[model samples]
Target: MTREAPRKRILLLTDIPPCSNLTAGIVTAQMCRFLPKDELAIFCVMNPHLRPMLCDDLAGIEMKTVRKPTELQRRVLRGIRVGRAGAAAIEAMKRIALPRRLIRQAIAYGRAVGATDLWAILQGQTMVRIAAPVARGLGVPLRVHVWDPLRWWLDAHGVDPVNRRLDLALFDRTLQQAASCAAASIPMARHYEETYGVPSTAVIASIDPALAQAPPPKLISDDSVVIGMVGQFYASEEWAQLVTALKIAKWRVGERKVVLMTFGHERPPNDVPDEHLRFMGWMDQPEVIRTLAEHCDIAYCPYPFAERMAEVSRLSFPSKVPTYLAAGRPILFHGPSYSAPYAYLNERGAAYLCRDLYPSAVYNGLAHLIEDSTLYEATALAARGAFLADFTLPRMERAVRRFLGYEGGKAGQAHGLEVV
Candidate 1:
């Protein structure tokens, strides 16, 4: 019999909690699911005021919650956001003051739990900045997972220019200090290596195995065809273009109708007519996938196209790609050619590609997928192949294992994330 690997206690010190239905929560939950719960613990820090987004899958895992954006942080951030001429607040935010209090809490928890390793998911800048130091104090290895480019993520969240520049530098330092790191996409991995001279493994999203075993979705009821969109909108400019494109595309094709069906986002888009919009509200990830499979004839995915978003566009991969691939529909991808998702899908011929932000391009790309049966079937087959080849539970599991230095036969190494 093969000898089972020895257990290594792991502490997940993160900014995103398991309760969020967002990418961080979904991806983090997947990473934790295969590990022994008894040897693992969670320390999450996020603003406590917002309602948890609820990913029921990870609720059973034990976790200690800490509040982020303390009153001082909030006031300082508000000052920066509104450009209140609060130079002191901006300066204070830019100064990285050792993160002593946060480090103390993490160390106490890590020692108490006998944690052998610290695995951080890059989300909140403060938590990410502290990861390297805390792991050093605990005398444990550190591994970080980056689902988005840290710089762009901060920019997207409206982090002020000064803090953002400082945080990016700290992020680079942490990357150098880490033993391994995992990125969300191949382009992201390449960017890390080329720009930072740090190699990282690409571990994108995955779908439940059961979802792949089933037959393709039944035809939508009635004469209406639906396009699927999942999760929150990150690129405001790109998504606004999509809204206009969907409008320009029209809602009817002969006797049949077409609509954009979306779930997970809290509010439905107000610009679209009720006739063109079908809101499913928020559902768990699994439920969202299954429902999309059942109701959607085509799935739409988006990325930013503005010059300002160019760097972020290349490094950030959407969580929806694998989920949509597993759902077995012809994907309608709208983004720039340089984008991670577009490049991946273009290479695989997995999705109908719309490579510009223009409404006409988006309208034409989606229309081709809907109107051309031959292209639709071919794209669907390729999408499934891509999912099976790269994005699956098994693949993600192995990547996570390698990142944490927990792969069955491998031995542990020095801390500081090198990216797995």
Candidate 2:
């Protein structure tokens, strides 16, 4: 009797535990889920510690948690302490020797599991240097996943310009060595092609429709309109502007409160009084969806319109937009025209987009959404339709598999492949 062919194995190196509801983690887990299970085996490696609230979906997949500095790394440090290595040598030992040691570990793990491919999924520059050596040593294809413009992001967040420049140079060199690179969006792919001259395949971060059911539609008879936002509250200037607009909206509506409901890492600013804002810090996916459906009439997407932010807007789509759409609500987006969300929503007439980037523009947009019921309903329908048609898990799965060089029947191709 003929023996069946063994499935190809792929080792995915990522930031944290897969499907931990973190943006990149969710995409990574979904990619693994969608790959042809009969043809490929997925193994994942995450550093430090895994999330306690890890997703229970990935059964039978091998997961390894790497504590920084393996046994070899510790031995090298011990040798340095014992005068066998000098102070200058310590930096090289930690930087060079440590990754090589980890590479050996990765090779052993890959061999044990019969992995034929090494994928270095990078959320940022943190793992690029280490992953490069690991992929090189394995003599297998290295697929690099680029999520954002890391150099621009660091520069925007106030990293030293010189250091950012240096890091950008290093990341470029690392990317050049990859067998293939996948971008998070088409704009991101264009950005990489222009800046780094590497042709990138676009594989957007998408939501799984089957993972959780959308909450029942909440009745909207209340006097107040609650505006909901999920994810980090990064741009305080924009937040202040949004709060100011909502206050104006409240006054115009009379006896109706304009509430800002937020979830995730940061809390609403101390200045945005308790009456105007409700902060629920760090909610899981289900809770976030339930809260949005029950309390929020409109979803808020805010982007700061600075030069750095303009660059950011052009390179990547906001992760929260898909989540907001899946909740089946109209979006009140405040961003530049170049941003992927703004461009998409504006083109599709799916959001009340405020492109002018001022308090007056945002106030007018919010007022329009609150006062016009017909417009609100239409926008909400469009948003949800967009999500179902193009941004669902099944569509994302096909896009990812195609980008990764999978060949098979085109069962999901009608939804369209978005590789740029």
Candidate 3:
């Protein structure tokens, strides 16, 4: 009897693209980078708006839209009949319940496309609950990647205590069903194990080396200092504190200014001192990277010091760190010392850690770095070296392959590195 051919089909279930530079998009892009483009038949189930973004160059991968009621449609239709509160309740129900329909559609698509493996990258708990039986029926392994439980929890609850409880229960149930699980960091992996009794592998979000090659530095005065922060600008109490710190820093430092490059919908307060604060509006990925490379002198990773933020710090690795590292710049991380990146930076001597969110500490740290050119360059070089060694695309690909039990004997040969 002839042996059956190895299955080459994969089903990737994720949110649609183009609106935000989320961790999900980053991981999906990384998967595209390493997965054998020619051999594997890929099918993506994503939001309708994201269809145009996943073009032909993605190794002939096919995309199918996961149809659901749009938020506006739901509000208009339900609010017209029912009260706004009732409509909102209905929308919440839909959010929790829609994944089942989405998964059924995914299963049908997978079977149609002859998929042998089911991979889920978003809606973790819901995806696991819905995809488990489908994978079992199809006799395929189910792989689930968890990036941030806090984000997922907040998304599910949104300040509703009852919904928060329901979300946690669902999250636990879904986590229990995953055949293989991956987390974004070591701390996250530990949290998964501790909370859900499931083993998970650490896989940080990766950067394409080609993209990591630095762009031409932006033109600025040699003596002018610019501290930069990038990514979303969701309003939070910590953000208010960040503004206060920046104000204090501006007062202390004569020539330096703080620049926030964001894709956030909300604008910074108009009254923020013009001399100290510069808000560069929404930038595309290339532009963001170029801005970071050319203009930034110090990278700020500031988040609120709250329970939810602490959970985020533990469970989610920051993608911006690699981007900053790639820019060959020093990072001023303002958060808990126990965070994974904080530990990593301390180990490498690449970041300055602050114990408190006080303005004085923030001011002092920024002042010292601005004055000490030797310290700044040394930290920058250390950060860049760390990225090249452990956080690049190739490193991530090998980790994913190992977690999938596909590590080859010659896998480390190209890098002249040994498998741990």
Candidate 3's displacement at residue 259, Å, is 4.9
- Please, what are the lDDT tens digits per residue for candidate 1 over residues 1-420? 899666789899887776655567767776777576676888887767656675565566668777664322233454345343464365355354546777888898889888899988877677766788889999998887787767666655666566668778889888887777788787777777676665578877776555762324333545776888888777666668777765555656445577878877565554878878888987876777788777788888888888877887888888888888888777889888988888889899989888878877877786677666678778888888887877777667677777777766432222211223
**Model 1 lDDT, full chain set:** 0.74
User: Can you give the TM-score per candidate against the true fold?
Assistant: 0.87, 0.81, 0.81
The sequence of per-residue lDDT tens digits that candidate 2 reaches over residues 124-181 is 4446546777777677777778777676555543434444465577788877776677
Clash totals for all models, in order?
12, 0, 1
The reply for model 2, stretches above 4 Å from the true place, is: 1-6, 36-52, 68-98, 156-163, 193-199, 210-219, 247-255, 410-420
RMSD of each: 4.9, 6.1, 4.6
Model 2, residue pairs in steric clash: none
- Most accurate candidate by lDDT: 1
At residue 236, candidate 2 shows an lDDT of 63
| Candidate 2, residue 288: lDDT | 79
Ten-residue segment with the worst summed lDDT in candidate 2? Answer: 69-78
Q: Native-vs-model 3 lDDT? A: 0.62
